[model samples]
Target: MPTYSRFLKEILSGKRDCDVKKMINLTENCSAIILNQMPPKLKDRGSFSIPCAIKTLEIGNALCDLGASVSLMPYSVFTKLEIGDLVPTNITLQLADRSVKYPIGKVEDVPLRVGKFIIPVDFVVLDIDEDAHVPIILGRSFFATAGAIIDVKQGVITLKVGNDSLTFDLTNTMHYPSSPSENCFFVDSLDPLVHDMHEHLLISNDPLDLAILNREGLGNLGVEVAKYKEQ
Candidate 1:
């Protein structure tokens, strides 16, 4: 059976007897945090990668982006999930390169399964490039709510949920494609055009200085400078 069909069937089936929200409470010792750590790799190519689950379905390629304010997902993924009903939003996202893309809208109550933790967040649906390698973009919205701690050197992302720390390793899954900057985050042009007034040209405050260039000839040259009296 298709994943989407199953999801809809379950939704239509009925609500389960549960608290709904993933809950966590800590003790006085703070022993609940185990310092979720990943094994040190012989050759660690630091990349922000983590496994994300939507409706308990693991998203193979999910990129962890700290620069982004809100979590984002391609509209294509939304269509694949067959999730219905999204709130209308008029938000404009500015790319790293300064270009902007408008999102279709936002879907509330979207829970992302990160490790054993359930991250309740919203995603702004947008039309992403079809060729985009990463299907899901985990932005700061998830990070802040999840209390994520990413260790770049160790290539690990850990989320402190309640008293447990859920971890995902990047060394095994994240692929560092050639010229990644062009693929994921927008790359700003190093050389930007700077505008300034040409220094060589100067205006004469006194028409006496321009007396050398006859005003009569200036009219013939299709050039005239406005004269102002010194206050």
Candidate 2:
């Protein structure tokens, strides 16, 4: 073996030892890998859902989607519950596909029974086909009202209400609903149009004018008239 002149000189001079092992520091990641101390790889647990009810009618599973701004309910479900009258809302929803969907109305303070807790939730009623598996989408509004703390790694979700708390294990209870033909959509924008017609519709006591605006005013305002089905 051909040794470098510098190294040979150092070895002969007794300044450096040939058989000495030098210690080097390793990064935390590298040390973990070498020592097999890395965390165990976990598989995708899927979407979080919980069994909730409105009165005696048990809604199968409600998908807890953080991406949605408003808690959404199909008009069909609202009718089935027959809980209360839907108040007219000026808020307009723009979907993920950039399509505008007009909500039928807003249902306020509907009691949602989850486990031992009866929480009040406001839902934006939309005219859309209800999913058999997961009929309702619980968004940030519901989460905030319920005080939801999602633990993605542990696959657990904790819902706190005052001094009480309820935790659901997503690993065991997670719902994997069969993929529907409709693309998954979320509310991307809220009340985009600042038109006078929308404002008038809000305060207009004349049913005839409100009806006319609901039919033609949105289209006339350059807002694309699209149904939730298209989204």
Candidate 3:
């Protein structure tokens, strides 16, 4: 097993802001971040990092996604397992598409380069559904520790962590959109005045009536509310 001491910094496009504190916690504990259809809610506060594959379009190359997710495992962990030691195990993985159960295991010790950072991670290779054509799926543990921002929009996944950001267009990637009805409409533009007022009222001392705003979608309104509080 080899220890990764170098830290990589890269910028990616089409990223949505994430709570920095939450990200730190995820890295510290080696937890995976799941992007799903339901409204955001925190769970699995503390747990052992699992080795799994990460599938996304913005990843560009197959190696990028593999390196992003499994690097969290310390060098000691890698040494404990051999190529055959890791076997196919059932695990649930979350992606922008659909959540599915897959078999994955720590296959080999591989070095991943993210800008200036070089990390050695235990590669968890697995065969996704028959429809999956990508090489592997990177787990959340590796991604969180990479200190990058992951963005999903218009079927694209982008990762920007550190000073460099990379975008992966999923036009040809293995994607499983949960359902057509699950799609949410995004507002292209909003009046600054209305936006400011809406934000102010939502963050005011009194409870807000978020339901009143029908013009803007609830997701946009909710994000605005969260931004107000975050500020």
Candidate 4:
């Protein structure tokens, strides 16, 4: 009989023939991994957006993305809206294509009316060509401020303020234009290089900021970014 160490060394060295078992006991997690019993993969659900307005200007489709650290607005849109004076900022943004972009300026506390809730949003103004379909990117910062609850599986997003809450169904809300010129814009990544100004401008303490919706502007609230109606 070989010693325990010698027996193990022989087995490892293939000097001794070891019996192979057809079945082996495994932990639940291991079994799941080996049997490929993980959650089913889902297709790209496209982007999630909401109808938002800044004062009088109605932004038909504002892309709500979790990938971005800060909200983004185009210079063209900035020029059109009289939300606030563009405050100069040193914060840098890196886009999806790994291209670096310097924002034109920053706008603070712009009242964004979504559904019946009025939430204050800070936007980083960029010089990119405004996508007629989706003009803005509402990043994680806005989500944090708005107390947003996203259900990717069901394609539902609920925004809460204090005790009040509003929900939107993406299936009905996402309408694309039939025009050939309509372009799609997406923010896959964002790298905000923090500076002195960036450090001071943190997420607002009052996340649940809310205001009553004006009945006079109800007509503009229904405007969709795209031209076509989706069934």
RMSD in angstroms between candidate 4 and the native structure over all alpha carbons: 22.0
lDDT of 3 at 175: 39
TM values, all candidates: 0.56, 0.64, 0.27, 0.62
Could you tell which candidate, 3 or 4, scores higher by lDDT?
4
Candidate 3 ranges beyond 4 A from true positions: 1-109, 113-119, 125-132, 175-231
TM-score of 1: 0.56
Residue-by-residue lDDT tens digits, candidate 2, 42-138: 8887888888898988876788888899999999999988988999998899887799999999999999999889999999999998888789989
Ranking by lDDT: 2, 4, 1, 3
Residues 26-69 of candidate 1: C-alpha lDDT, one tens digit per residue: 66445434554434457656457676688845677777788888
Candidate 2, superposed: residue stretches over 4 Å from native: 1-23, 94-98, 178-231
lDDT of 3 at 154: 39
Please report, as a residue range, the 10-residue window in candidate 2 with the lowest summed lDDT: 221-230
Candidate 4: regions farther than 4 A off:
1-25, 30-38, 172-231
Tens digits of per-residue lDDT for model 3, 16-74: 34345643434522433343334455432211121223222222334235433342222
Q: TM-score order of candidates, best first? A: 2, 4, 1, 3
- Which candidate number maximizes TM-score? 2
Looking at model 1, residue 145 earns an lDDT score of 85
Query: What do the candidate models score in CA lDDT, each in turn?
Result: 0.71, 0.83, 0.43, 0.80
